[model samples]
Target: MTAHLSRRTLLGIAGAGAGAYLLSACGSDEPSTPDGPQTINWWHIQNTEPMLPVWAAIAKEYETAHPNVKVVIQPLENEAFKAKLTTATQAGSPPDLFQSWGGGVLKQQVDAGLVKDITADVQPWIGSLLPASVQPFTIDGKIYGVPFDVGMVGFWYNKDLFVKAGVTATPTTWAELLTTVSTIKGKGIVPMALAGKEKWPGHFYWAYLAMRIGGLGALQQAAKDNNFDTPDFIAAGQRLKELVDLQPFQKGFLGAEYGSPDGQAATMGNGGAALELMGQWAPSVQASSSTSKKGLGDKLGYFAFPAVDGGKGTVAEAFGGGNGFVVGKDAPASTTDFLKVLLDAANQRKSAATGAVLPTVKDAADAIKDPNSKVVAASLASATGFQLFLDQAYPPAVGQQVNDSVAELIAGSKTPEQIVKDITKVAKSQ
Candidate 1:
């Protein structure tokens, strides 16, 4: 979903573009402080516990501190939020502050004149947050969103299932991973759980394979050249095809929903599958969706996506994105001011304490108490490189194309060469 420059340099690059915007009338680029009571409409996706109440409490506290500003909260489910936001932005209006992953979507909004440039407004404390986490929000040297959480995707496996299958070690290489899947399936165990109904989940396999084989810059270069017809990308598709041909996923996986009772998370949590390639949120989702509602607990393990034998990218390069908030074009000035209060270290700690987020505020790290989350935090801390999810990294149309093409590959309805050709056509048009 993203790329960025050196630490603290992202904002500093807002020289000419931001300067031009400042000189132009535009639409209140430097919004004035509120002169009277104002309502800030906020739309988020933390509709459930650990975060839902936390957000409410934060808004309440902010209102108490600044009676002149009223925060109107609207929490929607993830997919629902995306659809609604799409409709609103297309209609020429969005919530004052809304949920944003801050890559291609944010870029699209910016290009469409739907969001604000808050670089100057956030200058004072933006440096206190993790630079990498902020990277996705910075497009063309200007900051459009503020990240509250950051994470990466990896293999979340059932350690107990691995033991039962006699796979004593986690696979560190692609070849070994294939062997591990085969051994697990041979034991009559489902080797993997995938939400095939959701094209995004299936795309992870193809994206990671590309990252490993083509290296970190491979995808970026493709976007720059408006082409995916490359040997490395073709190899990525071919590798994913090899895995698909193994028939390692749970039955009905092709139609399974991600958070449904019989979905990918439930399958993994119930020990129906040995592993699932998912984001950092996997454990909690598994627990909530599973019959026990307690997940696998200590039996769950996280490992980096395995390396292809002759790959250029290392296991240390991470692939994921996290939540952030972006200001709408018509938002009142108090919106940015309230964001300062909302993202302060103390408030961020409240979020981290819930184990629902990998806090972007550096000082809030100690609040993470969940064991699985702790491992994920440590992994992100040590990552040598980072890339936002492929779907978010590219333009909206190109990103969707990537997901659709990859899903076709998994369905055995498309070849690697065809995947490249399809994506190239879309990317070139964009």
Candidate 2:
């Protein structure tokens, strides 16, 4: 996902009357010497150890070529980056450029008039980029950001556990999936590894259920308008409750912490969970484990979440899309040039080769050698429309409430109906 700079600061950048200039002069330590190396602060939320070497090499190359421009890469944890960015921007300490996802998140920034409109720079290249890959960032007949990595939510399953449970095939329908979960549980394996500690991951159930019951458009509209009281929204919650009844997810997962390496390792490695519904970005467990690479590579099977038993949508529909870079409004001429250079075919291809992302540019996608990376690229190409991440698409207050509702639902403290009611309450209030 894209790193968050303070939305608060960006609003000031957009138009703060005379206050912004005053603050910049009196308090801000602007990037030194515009006539010298234009040091652009680049914030990102892609913070895995594996990508460090790749990013370091790229930074070195970028600096070597443009000695007049310096890119300072600041890696921040996803949520932290968002919060910090919002705070900093409000405080008038916004970076020249930063990263952010498309959809509601981008809309919020764009609506605030914080992000720069780069439509002129992007027009010539639009013909060469995949339409689906570019859709999220294109708003109001103008492009405000450059497309980068895009991902999706799908089930990741353990083949060994499935075989041990005597399951011969992956489930495609709701009934079949339920039956498979039951069978897996009967064989002493956790049917799924749904982590509640990570609120974003938990939002998947709500969004996918909403998609299944009322179609993606309806779900998105409800979220966009905060109409959780609608019948469709309630029915979606009911569907989630049905899935919960199967006891598919690992026990006590509701209280698990986000990015808990220990918990993920336990769930997928030591624990007997046979499957997990997560993003394509969840790198292979082998990347984390010192164990044998067997049962890790392509063995990690993925499939879209099935539609509800008699729902409005097909199983092919999905919730997916991720983060990328956006230039702030009023970026220096040199900074703009640096960004243009950054997106040059050479840099994008090198970044894609790190196998940490599915590039938005065709050349970068083509240069990816990893099979999984290619799979993500292919999926992006095939999607009819990319749905934004649920929590991200919703307002922060409602998103927090939804996260609480998810944790409560999984812990059995709240029934599906109760979850629906709570979300409805929040939506109406909003």
Instruction: Report clashes for each candidate as comma-separated counts.
Output: 3, 11
Worst 10 residues of 2 by lDDT: 13-22
Model 2: per-residue Cα lDDT over 237-329, one tens digit each? 676677788878777776654234445434664434788666665444423431343326655666777757777876666466655678877
List candidate 2 segments past 4 Å from native: 1-39, 46-80, 258-262, 285-295, 334-337, 428-430
Q: Identify the leading candidate in terms of lDDT.
A: 1
Which window of ten consecutive residues has the lowest lDDT sum in model 1? 12-21
lDDT of 1 by residue, 254-324 (tens): 89878789988899989899999988778888887899999999999999999998999899877877778
Q: What is the TM-score of each candidate against the true structure?
A: 0.87, 0.81
Candidate 1 C-alpha RMSD relative to the actual structure: 6.8
lDDT, candidate 1, equals 0.81
